[model samples]
Target: MNGLSGMREENERLEGEVSRLRTELSQAAAGDGGGEKVNELLGEREAIQAKVEAMLDALAEIDPEIAAAVAG
Candidate 1:
């Protein structure tokens, strides 16, 4: 019961993080900034996206329905 609750909490947290990271990535892409800065943001976004994917993978094991909702 506690473990299920914890998984739900973690799932929500990861979903929020993924949303925030995606918003940041979109904003960064929209900006007309320096090439170096854009490249840096792209790298950061890639790292964040990777983390999100990993979290979703773990979540799928704990709760496939929630994971599918998040992924979709």
Candidate 2:
């Protein structure tokens, strides 16, 4: 039970972090920059976003209890 609760909390935290990263990426994308670092960050952000989404999907399929706990 404690483990499940901890997992739920971690999941929520990760979701929030991913949301912030997406927002940051969007803001950075709008800025005027022409460098490989910017391109790399954009790409990394996109990949991380996709992975986070995929993780959410997988968790949803794998555990109904955790999904309900983590979901709004």
**Each model's lDDT:** 0.69, 0.68
Best by lDDT: 1
RMSD (CA, angstroms), candidate 1: 4.6
Tens-digit per-residue lDDT, 1-72, candidate 2: 245466567668767876776676677677766345457767776776686666666677778975786597
State the TM-score for model 1: 0.52
Best by TM-score: 1
lDDT of 2 at 39: 74
For candidate 2, the 10 contiguous residues with the lowest summed lDDT are 1-10
TM-score of structure candidate 2: 0.50
**Which regions of candidate 1 are displaced past 4 Å?**
1-33, 67-72
Clashes of each: 0, 0
